[model samples]
Target chain A: AQSVTQPDIHITVSEGASLELRCNYSYGATPYLFWYVQSPGQGLQLLLKYFSGDTLVQGIKGFEAEFKRSQSSFNLRKPSVHWSDAAEYFCAVVASGTASKLTFGTGTRLQVTL
Target chain B: DTAVSQTPKYLVTQMGNDKSIKCEQNLGHDTMYWYKQDSKKFLKIMFSYNNKELIINETVPNRFSPKSPDKAHLNLHINSLELGDSAVYFCASSPFDRNTEAFFGQGTRLTVV
Candidate 1:
């Protein structure tokens, strides 16, 4: 079974400061990785996805993620975060064969300070 | 227009009552799914349908039933809802291709009191 682990339960960052949310996955084969953001009372929105090639994947709202095979990790990064970026972030994984079945982590709540 | 939409964004009902959440996708995707987000913000797939055919049914309780009348619509019906069932339910759709990403709806927050 494929599982995603987001070790940070919550993170607080000052506005305009750099941010990184760590995500680790355990899968037997190559995994399809994704990052999703959910605002308060809103549904999850796809930030970006990693299918193949180009380990460095860019996403919406000036966000990006790097997939490191050796570390079994796909961490989301931003050079600077805005107050609106504060939300619950989830790291998800899709097994090689099962595309529709997305296994998500417990999620990381991001709080941006002004 | 919303790519994926679910009816009754907020549903508050008493325990032991039955309710249904309807989902429709305008993206014309072939696969649709229902996902549950618990209070702790853990998301898990509950059911999936491909071309109106049941494809994946996770270890969810039988009280939770999903119906797909067509490829573009998927509805979830819960029977005798329990307090534990209070969570946000999301509907999503995606192409049949393995590399495609799923588009999610606004979600239906079901509260059982």
Candidate 2:
């Protein structure tokens, strides 16, 4: 079945440290990958999405993700982590069709330390 | 603002009860969706409606019903809710198809005790 996997369940990074959250997906066609950030007591916000064109896509809040077709991976990265950036990150993929229903990963929680 | 919005940000109810969550989007979107965020904060699409028609329905229980009166409105009605139903229900909207970035609402935290 089609699915999205975020191998890292939980990650911790210092306020100024670089951060990376990895994601892999299983799909048959050209997948439409997306990264979403969920702050505490809030809804999921779109960080970035990859539909076509360049493999590296830039997103809001100084975040970016690269979609690698060979690896079937779309990893989210940040140059410097902030205390406020500590939140749950999810990677999702839309099925190939008009439905385009999104399949989300279990999620990866990032903890920012001092 | 041209954004998706949901009402009753917080709901606290008991099991075996019935409740409804309402959603609205003024983004001139043609599709509206209902998603559930579990306790562990995993978001999944529950249902989708396009042009007031049900397009995609996941393997959700029949107790949970979604009604789209119009293109801009879709409401979820849950009957005889169970303890496992306790989670955050989110409402989102997209302009046309699956490739579009969906706009989300603040979410309705439904608590079943």
Candidate 3:
């Protein structure tokens, strides 16, 4: 079974600080990976995705994630996080392009402080 | 404009009462889904429909019925609601398949008294 694990349940960082949210997946083969953000009482918004690429994928709001095949990880990173970036982050993996059912992680709640 | 929307954002009902939550998407996507988020914050997929056809049905109770009228609308009807039925239900739609990012609704909070 495909599964995703996010060790950090919650994280606190100061404004303008670099941020890194870790994500790991267990799958039989290379699967479609994605990162999404959700604000309180709001729906989820796609942050980034990785399929077949240069390993480093860039996304909206200055967010980026690197696909480390060896490590089975797709960790999200941002050079500088804005206050508006405070939200819950989720990492997901689909079995394949055709069997597109996503398995999501528990989620990481990010808190940005001044 | 809301891409995906669900009606009755908050629902409070009795344990034995039956209720249905409506969902619609204007993105013209071919696939729609229903997910449940438990009190422990664990999100799980319950049902999925593609072009009004049932595609994926997880290990959900038969009391939970999902109906898709068209390619853009999917509704969830719960029968004989129980205390465990109290959770946040999310509706989502995707264009081609799950490979693409799935657009989600604001979610509906269902509480069984």
Q: Could you tell me which 10 consecutive residues in candidate 3 chain A have the lowest summed lDDT? A: A94-103
Listed for every candidate in order, the interface RMSD values in angstroms are: 1.1, 1.3, 1.7
Worst 10 residues of 3 chain B by lDDT: B94-103
Cα lDDT tens digits for candidate 2, B2-47: 3888989999999999999999999989999999998888788899
Q: Arrange candidates by TM-score, highest first: which order?
A: 1, 2, 3
Interface RMSD of 3: 1.7
* Residue pairs clashing, model 1: none
List the lowest-lDDT window of 10 residues for candidate 1 chain B. B94-103
User: lDDT: which candidate is best?
Assistant: 1
- For each candidate, the alpha-carbon lDDT, in order, equals 0.95, 0.92, 0.90
Cα lDDT for residue B78, model 2?
100
TM-score of chain A of each: 0.97, 0.97, 0.97
C-alpha RMSD by candidate, in order: 0.8, 1.1, 1.3
lDDT of 1 by residue, A13-91 (tens): 9999999999999999888899999999999999999999999999999999999999999999999999999999999
- Cα-based lDDT at residue B41, candidate 1: 88
Can you give the lDDT of residue B22 in candidate 3?
Answer: 97
Off by over 4 Å in 3: A97-99
The count of residue-pair clashes in candidate 2 stands at: 0
